[model samples]
Target: MPKVIAQIYPSLGGTSEMSRHRPIGRDPYAFHTVMHGLRQIAQAMDELGYWGLSHVEHHFHSEGVEVSPDPGLWNLYLGQYTKRLRHGQFGYVLPARDPLRLAEEIAMIDHMLEGRLFVGVARGYQSRWVDVLGQRIGVRASSPGDRAGERRNKELFFEHFRIMKLAWEKDLLQYRSRHYEVPFPFESGIADWPAAGLTREFGVPGEVDDDGALRGVSVVPSPFQDPHPPLFQPFSQSRTTVAWAARNGLIPITTFAPIETAGWFAGLYRDEAARAGRDYALGQNMGLVRSFSIHRSRSAAQDAIERYEMLAWREWYGSFGHLGGFRFPGEEGQVPRPGEDVAARLQQVGLIIGGTVDDVKRQLDVQLSAVPFEYLVWHLPYAVMPLGETLDQLELFAHEVMPEFGMTPPEPPRLRVPESSRERPETRASEG
Candidate 1:
């Protein structure tokens, strides 16, 4: 049976309705509501038997879309409210962060969650935040078109990724690369007299040399999970990334690819893993991320997609060229015109599944049969859906859809409310 993970995109609800407030991302009350809704989702998913709950890491969203800036903190906060559900980010944009700090934070979070943590890293695509945060390191965000920027970003991403893994797996760490040196001066090391004796006596061996120079650093309180928690790379579309992930034993979550593309990537990953001496079935170490809307009627499901998802694509993701992912193999260069019904296009390719229980089940059956993916990530658009509606969809899928795939929850869902009270008034209007 496949593990189901809920990927939360924390958009501040009702941004379109609150024009006077403009960017609801800055509204404390709205932010509070989103945080509370996250808690509610976490608690509910724990009961619904979700394997994990994940969030995204983005910043400076004054327009109130994808406002989850600190996913690690969110994981620590939500971990307290649920026992069974693992918490993590779909990913942290690695090029924009100091990998050592990220490693330490993740380790602490892992301990706090009592081994219920996973780590995800990404080569960032958003310049709005990434360029600003990465300015200190002279790093810039890149997309497929920016060849030079993309290469630089990949270099930083790969270097940072290795450093984090070393911190988790090794007792003492010393690293050097084009962008970073662990001890600042790699050759000389830190010549500090303070705490040298204490560290030599108490810390891991070789942390300080005989002459009292700090030779290596130790990332304290190693992860609660053995060695470290599972690592993941999200929205993995390229063949290069799949091969790298396979070699490193990191699960690659395919979000934008169509089933045919995803299946090809899965096979590539399997072959690469075998070459790396880690043999696996076609989709055993892979995940697929999909948006879903389960409703009583197919049209109603389509309506939900238009209301909750299309606006975001039109205003945000489309501008970033992400909507192109919905294009079929031959239509890779096609771009949607203004006012195009992108929701329908997405559905035509089966990128976003929608319909009644049976319809959703059938669509999933077809898609899953193609790849046999081991993990299914439910990408929830929390900004547009009310807490009640989101819960309703989760419950519907957990009870009706998951069983067909052999995913049985330990306990029945316990958060069903009367239909009349499900839509909170503040979130009734769709976000712009």
Candidate 2:
């Protein structure tokens, strides 16, 4: 059976931080700090025996979130720090990045992790980001994410993904597409020697197109995992995304309204997979504790939760938001800020966990037993709490509550695997 592969993205900001292309902090090291802390967290998780950690990718976040443009660096950093902790990126927004460059970097990370990396790919959604990349969201902006600019970005994504796969799997690569093409011939003297067997499987190697150009092409250091690390699509709460993933055999990470809601969506995804004749063996972590409070003590937690309620009201329910006065983080044209119906706003998205770690655990289990999510990530914004406080909550969760959830920190690379074998493919593959 595929063990549950859950990703915990301890973002600096929460949903509230999502605004017009703004990130939580201006300091460049915001992401770096998170990466450093993640190693510690991963170390703890390994000690406690947890499974995986995934980082979020966003161009702009509301208040306390960190957007990682160069996630490859973080991946490498974490990969070097922990031995067996599975690392994931909840996707690199396709159009906002250079596909080929991203492909090489992603391949390197895969090699570094010995294939423990799972990729989540999506078309850039926010208008702010799309614009930054010089893409347009025009009339489609009104439609939901998948519908707006969906076709172009998805096409670009698939095109890039296919190309990346070809580059990684093939020896001398030849690609000719409308927008991109590269041909390599046999005489290019490309040195391709990866320690991992999976690298050879990723592409078909032969230099030169019919034009007979020297094949100097090779993806350096093939992926560390076998075959290839999976490609997960962000579930858009749409059958389109789900069915597409099901048909294509993609793993998925999605959000649920609450515990019961999570179970329902997971069942939907599983059913779609089954119906599509795809492997049900693929794992899913579709639970999200969005904009929730995790506090060192009950009082702080309660106060934060109340503030979240207020935030929900201020952002979504209040009249200022409703009449189309404002726009979503990635929207153009303009939308009303929102109307105030604080309770209804809270009702819009449920806060399933609030009280204590134990309280959170009980609620989480109730949802997990039904939906069986492989991972659950929390969205603890920086609005109400300080970063230090958030860290305490994270530490506490790692030390106290994670054990109940059957998760513990990973062992150091040396203890987890023989140091001599760290350079060996056998060691990395087995770790996965």
* Best-matching candidate per lDDT: 1
Q: What is the C-alpha lDDT of each candidate?
A: 0.85, 0.54
Which pairs of residues collide in model 1?
Answer: none
Model 2 scores what on Cα lDDT?
Answer: 0.54
Residue-wise C-alpha lDDT for candidate 1, range 1-432, written one tens digit per residue? 788988887888654644756777788988888899989999998988888889989999887888889999899999999987889898999988888899899988988888788888998889989889988887889676888888889999999999998998888999987688978798899997599889999888998989888887888777877778889999898889999999999999997768888888899999999999998998998999888999999999988998888767667788888877775666644655456578777777777899999999999999999889998998888857888999999899989998899975433213224345576554576642
Cα error, residue 25 of model 1, in Å, equals: 0.9
Best TM-score among the predictions, by candidate number: 1
lDDT of 2 by residue, 122-226 (tens): 665556556565443231211244564655666666677777767656645566666455632223432443322343444444432223333445655555544
Candidates in order, TM-scores: namely: 0.91, 0.68
Clashes of each: 0, 60
The alpha-carbon deviation from the true structure for residue 177 of candidate 1, after best TM-score superposition, in angstroms, is 2.2
Model 1: CA > 4 A from native: 18-20, 330-340, 409-432
